[model samples]
Target: MSKIDQFMSGRLRERKDKLSIRNLSTNILPVDFCSNDYLGFARSGELKHLINTNLASMPDYLNGAGGSRLLSGNTKFTEETEQFIAGFHLAESGLIFNSGYDANVGLLSSVPQRGDTIITDELIHASIIDGCRLSHATRFKFHHNDINDLEDKLKLSKGNIFVVVESVYSMDGDMAPLIAISNICERYQANLIVDEAHATGVFGANGRGLINQLKLTDRVFARIITFGKALGVHGAIVLGSKNLRHYLINFARSFIYTTAAPIHNVAAVRSAYQYLNKIDHQLIHQKIALFRNTLKEQNINAIDSESTIQGILFSSNEAAKLAAAHLQSKGFDVRAILSPTVALGKERLRICLHTFNTDEEIISLVNHLQELN
Candidate 1:
């Protein structure tokens, strides 16, 4: 066997021993408590119809972007879509990337210089972490959502300071104290960058996002809004000053080097934004309340979350996996989030609620959770 193969096998065996090995499966179950389609937009027939209609209306639409946006891929339609989305979120301008990961990485990796400092929440998304790593900036992580801790970190930061956070944390599903954080950043003269990936289609008027809901858009230096989660499509956009848009176009390597997203994705994004105005976002909040109330009534402990992404903590990877298997066997599509994706003993069953989920489903899932607990 090759020496590299031996090393890879050893790593795989270690993951197996820890009960934390990862694999992909296509066997989706009947009930969906595992997906990120919080508003059912991904499966919405109306959304699909809107996308089709938009595509048909476009003249000579191409199946793919022939090159990077800087090359042959730039189009009037794509540029218009970016402007429309930015206007929806009340941003000065916007730039689209292939995905949320690309947007986060590109923005973080390029914006902060060697003397700069990047202070992030301890639980920021993996993509943001990767972006920070690629950057030449000094980095520090404060306690998750702890304003005091964030301030403490900010006091020690040098050069140009960038404060990064997510509006809604993915694993814990709790919100960052954006108002407090923004105030702190203003005092420190730090640039605040918010990842609105999970909040894009779940908050604000017409699903604008938590940042827009809080009316802190002007204070924030930059915001990354993704289309995949609640928007139920692909690609992402960085929203900020027109200069920041121009800066990313020239400097963000991930954006500058990669092929531009296809015209189809641009059309879908445009359609999704139009459809966003018509969605009943309050329905999702109702489901979140139902799930949390059920857990409380049954005396089952869960992570505190007002968002659709809910988590039930487990003591170990094996326990979380077993609970997920039990739910899967019962025909519910729930999954385990084991360490080191999260810290040890912070393993959990990540339950995602949706507007389309019935009260019966929520109750039944909570009952099953009670049994596990």
Candidate 2:
């Protein structure tokens, strides 16, 4: 075997020994408690119809962007779409990237300099961590959602301090204390960057996100809005000042180097944003409340969440996996989230609730969880 092959095989074996090996599967079950389509937009024929209608109106619509935005890919339509999204979110300007990962990495890596400091929640997304690693900045992590800890970190930071957090955490589904965090950053003169990936289509008027809902947009230095999650499409956008937009255009390597997203993807994002305004977001919240109440009635313990993303903690990876298998066998699409995705003993069953999910499904899922617990 090649030396590289031997090295890769050794790492795979170690993952297997830890019961943390990862694999992709197309074997989706009948019911879905496992998707990020919180509002059923991904499966909505109406959204598909809107995208098609939008595409039909565009002249010379191509299947792919011929080059990077700085090259042959720049289009009036794409720029207009970005402006529309920015206006929708009440931001001064916006820049679209291929995905949420790209947006986070590009923005975080390029904005902070060598003498700067980036303070993030301990549970910030892996993409943000990668971005920070690529940066020349000093980095520190505060306890998740702990305002006091965040303030403490801020006090110790030097240079241009950038405070990063997610509006709604992916694994636990809890919200960051944005108001408090923002206030703290203001006091420290730190730049606040919020990842609204999970909050984009789940909060605010017309799904402007939690930051917008809380009227914190002006105070925040930047907000990353991802379309792949609740928006049920592909791509992402960083919303901030027009200066930040121009800065990313020139400096964010991930944005500057990659091929621009296809025109169709951009069209879909535009359509999703339009559809987002029409969705009755309260329905999803209702579903969340029902799930929480059912869990309470059934005496099932789950990570407290006011959002569509919910989790039931398991003591070990084996326990979480067994519980997931049991649910899958019962025809639900629930999956286990095992360490080191989460810390050891913090392994869980991540349950995503959608507007289309029926009360019966929520009750049944909770009852099954009750049995497992």
Candidate 3:
């Protein structure tokens, strides 16, 4: 056989050995217990219609971004969306990116220059780590969500410190100590950036983010919000000062080189925000409350979460796999979150709650998990 075949065969065996091979498939089961469409926006036919309608008005921007924004991609709609997003987050400005992953890599990699110090939470997304790898600054990781630990690290950090963290911990469904973290950043005169990927559409009264919930937006240097999660679309935006906005457009590689996201997608995001502002948001909150109550009733209560994500810790990867399979067997769509996604020995069954999930479905899934362990 060819060397390519030999490589593929060897990799297959390695996956079998480590249980690490990934394959994609669609298994339509019962009510979803495993998607990040927190407010049911992903499946909203109304929002889709809005996108289709508004798209016709922008025929000039159809097809592609044409080229990078620095070339010809930047358009009137891009500016409008950026203005709307920035104002929503109460930032001086906003920079659009293709996805949350891209925004993290683009900004983190470029902003912290050589001889500067960069500190991030241990539980930050892998994209941030990769960005740090490309950065010119020295990288350090503080213990997750512990402001005191972060302060201690910051105290020892060198020139031009930048502290990075998430408004919501994606894996654990818990929040960071934002007020305290901002204070620490303030005391040391360090800049702070918060990733609000999972907190959007579920935290602030206007579904702005956890920072708005805590009234801490102005205190931080930057905040990143993804449209794919609670907003239920694709792409992301970084909220910051106008100088930082201008800087990223001019210097951030991902923004400068990438084909600006299609104009239609940007329009869809604008529609999503419009729907958010007018909808009865409490409906999702009520659904999440029901989900948490069911978890407690089944004695499978999650650890330290106040958001829509409910994680049931299985501790061992094997056990988590078994639990996930059991949920699937019972006709649920939940999946096991294994290591390399989360740290080893902390694997879990991440149950994502949506606004439309029935109370009965929620109870059935939790009771099934409880019965497994």
Candidate 4:
């Protein structure tokens, strides 16, 4: 066998031995304790109809973008839709990428130049970490959500510094103190970038994001809004000034080299935003409050979170897996988040609450969790 094949086999065996091997499972079970469809936009018949209506209007609609946006993929309709999204999100400009991963990869790898430094939260998403890795910038991580640590890092940072963090962390579901961080960035003259993946469609007056909710749009350097989570679409956009948009267009490799999102995907996102503007999100907020109260009343030891994502850390990967399996057996779709995805002993059952998730489901899931404890 090839030497490469032998190495691959060893890696696979190591994962299996650690009970951390991953695979795709298509089983659709009764309850959903795990999913990023926080607003249930993915399952919305109304959104489906809106997408169809938009696509039907486009007589020249294609299944895929014929080429990268810098090539043949740029279209008048798509550009106009981007403008609409930017306006809705209260940004001066917006640039869409195929996914949150590509947006982060493109933005991080290109924006921070050779002499720059990136100071980030220790627990930012892996995509953000990968983006930083691809950059030529010097990187430093402060303790997660600790503004004091961030301020200390800022004092020591050299060159053009870019501060990175998620508005709502995906795993822990806790919000970053964006206003405080923004203030520090202002004081230090460092550019601030926030990944609002878990915050979009779930915060703000119109669900713009945490940055928007806090009224710090002008203070932030750039904000990344992901459609896949709350918007329940398939892409992401970086919201910033027109010059920054131009810069990314010229230098962001992920955007320049890849095919732009298809017309249908863009239209669907536009429709989702339209739906977002009109829909009442009070029900979702109520559900979120209900879940929080349920967790508290039951004395569950989850990380404090105002957002929909919640996690209960386990002592070991095996223990988390067992607990997750038990919940799944009871007809809930909770999944085990294991180490190296998370730090050792921080393995957890990552439960995602949704707008469509009923009260009974939350009660049952929490009840099952209490029993596990």
**Could you tell me every candidate's TM-score relative to the true structure?**
0.99, 0.99, 0.96, 0.98
CA lDDT of every candidate: 0.94, 0.94, 0.87, 0.91
Give per-residue lDDT, candidate 3, residue 147.
80
Write candidate 4's Cα lDDT for 19-82 as tens digits: 8999999997788768999889999999999889988899778888889999989999888988
What shift in Å separates residue 196 of candidate 4 from its native position after superposition? 0.5
Off by over 4 Å in 2: none
Where does candidate 4 have its weakest 10-residue lDDT segment?
277-286
Model 4 alpha-carbon drift over 4 Å, by segment: none
- Candidate 2: residue 10 Cα off by (Å): 0.7
Q: List the residue pairs that clash in candidate 1.
A: none
> RMSD of model 2, in Å?
0.8
> Which has the higher lDDT value, candidate number 1 or candidate number 4?
1
Off by over 4 Å in 1: none
Model 1: per-residue Cα lDDT over 1-373, one tens digit each? 8999999999999999999999988998999998999899999999999999999998688888999999989999999999999999999999999999999999999999999999999999999999999999999999999999999999899999999999999999999999999999999999999999889888898789999999998999999999999989999999999999999999999999989998989999999999999978788888988898889999998899999899999999999999999999999999999999999999999999999889999999999888886
* Model 3 residue 110 lDDT score: 87
Q: Write the per-residue lDDT of candidate 2 for residues 1-373, one digit (tens) a residue.
A: 9999999999999999989999999997998999999999999999999999999998678888989999988899999999999999999999999999999999999999999999999999999999999999999999999898888898899999999999999999999999999999999999999999999888998788999999998999999999989989999999999999999999999999999999999999999988987778789989999999999898888888999999999899999999999999999999999999999999999999999899999999888888785
Clashes of each: 0, 0, 0, 0
Instruction: Give candidate 4's whole-model lDDT.
Output: 0.91
Q: What lDDT would candidate 2 get against the real structure?
A: 0.94
Q: Cα lDDT for residue 29, model 1?
A: 97
* Displacement of the residue 345 alpha carbon in candidate 3, Å: 1.1
TM-score of 4: 0.98
